[model samples]
Target: MGGSKTSLAFLVLLLIGLLSGTSSDAHSLSYNFTINPRPRPGQPWCEVQGEVDQKVFVSCDCDRAEIKYLSPLGEEVKSMNAWETQTGTLRDIGDLLKEHVSDVTPERHMVTDPLTLQARMTCRCEDDRHISGSWQFGLNGQMSLHFDSENGHWRVDHPGGRWMKEKWENDRAVTEFLKKVSMGDCPAWLQDFMVCWEKMLKTSDAHSLCYNFTIDPQPRPGEPWCVVQGQVDENVFLSYDCGGAKIQSTSPLGEEVKATHTWEIQTETLRDIGDFLKGQLSDVILEKHTARGPLTLQARMTCQCGENGHINGSWQFGLNGQMCLLFDSENGRWSVGHSGWSHMKEKWENDRAVTDFLQRVSMGDCRAWCKNFMVRWEEMLKSTASPTSGPPAVQPTATAIGFTIGIAVGVAAGFGIIILGWIIYKMR
Candidate 1:
């Protein structure tokens, strides 16, 4: 009995180790991965049609995710209270950060010094305590350290030491310093360096936001679409919604382009852009859709054209202000002259950063296109706002009777073959 108990305790310890190891797999608050939660067992996605139009909402809010901005070392943290939030993920970090910053009560406004806005950073540290360090700017730009020294180890009690260093500038210095000081071995020079680094962060007004969330994307297989939350600019949030947003097709293409979701973002209409495109290229047809919303979600269709409107390219459209297509267009022969939009027009002639998305459709593999057009359509409108002007298409699905007829035809063909063989043998 004692031996069994010992074995049980050992097994418990082993399980505890496993669980502790997996703790690193946690998301910033959310993560990105493919999911196919709709299909029935053993059934390929080909069996389902409506799955292509389905939308799956991704939760970017993580309970553990954090958004860190210019808590410049020496300078007071703009959102000091936010440094303690440990829940929420990428899904809602933008909103969370916004809320955190907005919630901080503002003091009397004063004409402040010129602070750099180089970057708005978001990071998920192994220990949230590591994200910040101790130091503050005293009156007249005086700097003071708020760390405690004990047993030859230096530790910051107020969570304000590490933030003083630039995230990447001379990262080697911090790395070398941290290699020694990371484990509570902070020295005087390291503390001063931290203060200078934090100053750089507080002064910069513009820069790329960095994310270092510990993440494990729990991707569901066969999940058609995925959503990702990120920012291209400091305050501008970007969303790539791939939930069942499908690419449309015209006659000759037969849905050659995979139906995919357009990246949803705050941007303009595509028809106005299409007009711009039409001004540049002759004979342009822009198919557009306006989803119901206050913003009037818009989509403008641009088909890939070969000789005589033979479509060789296709793309998925999103309610957001972006479009991407892989087309073998004769129109590409002309130099795209839009001073601001030439890069997009010239994109995908040969795939670089955006060709890895392969979506399976009834037609074939649809490569994901990432060219964004910032042009607005003539206007955002609703279907109910306008009367129906075109005849609806009528498609009749073939029934099981068609299969019966095929079977009957095959039986007749077999009988005829047998009879012909017998006749040939008898004649010989």
Candidate 2:
């Protein structure tokens, strides 16, 4: 009985050791550290580099994992275990091993994470005196971690760090500039210009901004003068002189035009005239006219199509050298006559000259009229009696000959009918 009790006590102690070991294994402690930068699209990976406390303790709830060392570059160094043994340190001094080491073959291990949503990292390194294995944090959705030994220290490296930093700086600068401009806090000199500039930007009309400034020339008293005008591009500091109806660009990209004018102002408001001309030619000027001559008047005239399907018009010169003209397209005709005093003979001569000119202008359509005239001539020849020819008047003779032929045919039909009647009566 004593031997049996001792055996029972030994079995109870062994059962207690197994239960305690399973409970410890089920409730193992884990440490997780994260370092998140601001979220940005197209960024490859988020990095986490920090250290953990030395003492290994068991806990159910924790707010944050403790960081033990802060490197010179402000990163944290941490260590963890990969295997379930829990008997050896995973990482030690001067061990450069990346997280998420993957083994493709039985012998070769590559540090890569194919999944984009989650990442599992494990690293190990050994020297003659020290051996280390690192258990890193898991990431989701495709990520990769790199490790390197720099100056006898281990550090995590991000590949796209420099590009991301530059992009961030550029975005910040543009945003700040826009904010300041929108708030109307720009410089005094630029405030007025900004109103137009912002309108151009919103509309995206480069042409309007191409010519924003203007110059108006004033005339001295008692002198007829010309106005000089200029325009400037707001974006580029380019100026164009439009004084001569000519454009001179201040920059290579500036646009220029040569302008011409028919009217000149001697007593009108220079500002008003300048504004008017500017409206007409957006970037042109009106230069002074050194020579003078009689004003030439020209008018645009149109004629409707007539029954002949043609349009016609003519210009008539007057005695005063002015012109008065009337065009009649409805009847395919035109009349041009002068009224100024010269002489009766001269007036008639001038009228004939004008008529001849009209005829020359309408010569293309004259072919139709010529064809009608020839047709009328042919009809007249067939209807009229010959004056000096052998053919004489024979209308009465021709009528008598037709009447005689009709009487002869009637007598022949009557005789043939009588003969047929007599033969029928005899046969009956």
Each model's TM-score?
A: 0.17, 0.14
Model 1 residue runs over 4 Å out of place are 1-311, 316-401
Each model's lDDT comes to: 0.23, 0.24
Candidate 1 lDDT tens digits, 163-203: 33223223454333222221222122222232333333231
By summed lDDT, the worst window of 10 consecutive residues in model 1 runs over: 47-56
Q: Looking at candidate 1, what is the lDDT of residue 182?
A: 18
lDDT (tens digit, per residue) of candidate 2 on 1-428: 56555655564555455433321000001122221122224321222221111111211101123322222211111232211111111121101112211211111112231221111222111111011122221122111222111111122222222332233234544334322221112121122222233332221111111111222233224322222222111112222222343333333222211121201221122233334433422111121112321111111122212334433432221111112223332333333322211332243344655345334433333223323322333333222212223211121232234335545545555554555455445545
Which TM-score value belongs to model 2? 0.14
Q: Enumerate clash totals for all models, in the order shown.
A: 56, 20
Model 1 whole-model lDDT (C-alpha atoms): 0.23
